[model samples]
Target: MSWAIIQQSLPMFGKGFELTLWLSFVGIIGSIVVGLICSLVQYFRVPVFRQIASVYVEISRNTPLLIQLFFLYYAFPVLGIKFGAQLCGIIGLIFLGGSYMAEGFTGGFNGVSKSQVESGKAIGLSRWQLARYVVFPQGFSLSVPAMAANVIFLIKETSIFTVIAIPELTNTALDLIGMYYRSNEYLFVLVIAYAIILVPLSIILTLLEKRVRYGTFGN
Candidate 1:
């Protein structure tokens, strides 16, 4: 907490926090795309794909992320795929986050009453039409809050990337500690730095949850 240490760590923490923000943003987008696709497969019960998505979600959720990162970084190279630590870290985190998001969306799909879907079918709508025009839009509201929470969780989870030398916030804080041997001072800034990025996301997600509910149920 010394003034000198605070001044010294600012640049390092800022740079690292920037990288963490960018990494989380990119990973969350990738996870959302993957999650939605997988959810669709599960919804329609596509041939063999439901099985595949199930396996993926179960395995990803069951395994620790650190292990996934190691597999991506160490095992993939053995299979002739070259990747930097940052790339590998992103891939692992996306795979992990996508599974959780898919589960959340599946819950959303369930939240839409079967009667709504039946009504869509009664209107001469095909399954695809019902899903696109009716079901997905309505059902997705049921899970948007969970989905947003998952995204926020992904932001905090980026702390693990420090283990991979990803130059994220935690990594830079540790580096500062190493350089100045002021672990206490650097750690405090690290906590605040992450909070600065994440606290607003939490607030946004809460507001979004209310909005989704209002749109789906209130109106």
Candidate 2:
């Protein structure tokens, strides 16, 4: 392991880390929004949207994320759409992660007791009002820990963006390896950098998951 190579590559790794975090941030937010919309539409059986959401969830869940990224980055331009590599990566993460998140949310939404629905109905609450005031809160609490796990997976998956030449951590490490001809050291450092971000997140999410399960989340 070449400490000299690793030391020299630190700055590039720092920049790469920043970009990875940015993509993760955008991906997590987008996935949650998309997932919630998909889950809600499916849960409520909203007219046309329910069917569309079903198809989207099916395709996104079944497909490989790398293929999705390729389609977004490579195929879209052939059909007259264009986006930067980072944007393509972010879009892919949202599309793929959102499908899994939708499933998580669907499970959570379903976990809400039938009695809650009946109670809302007894109070003359409209469908939207019940969802907004009661169901969504409980569903969100149940789903967030699962969604946090998805966020971690999505962040790691962003390394695939290097294929499109997005300067994420893996790309940075690869570049350093190529420049210094020391793959082992660079790869080792790369793993450490990723762990730095993901480890704490995993611990926090574990705590939150326990809180949610024990009915002490908000307190």
Give the candidate number with the greatest TM-score.
Answer: 1
Q: Candidate 1: TM-score?
A: 0.95
**Model 1 CA deviation exceeding 4 Å by range:** none
Error of 2 at 153 (Å): 1.1
In candidate 2, what are the lDDT values of residues 90-204, reduced to their tens digit? 8999999899899989988887889988999899999999998888888888787778789888888888888888999999998877887788988998999999999998998
TM-score (C-alpha, index-matched) for candidate 2 = 0.92
lDDT of 1 by residue, 120-145 (tens): 99999998999898878887888888
Off by over 4 Å in 2: 215-219
Clashing residue pairs in candidate 2 are none
How does residue 171 of candidate 2 score in lDDT?
93
lDDT of all predictions? 0.88, 0.89
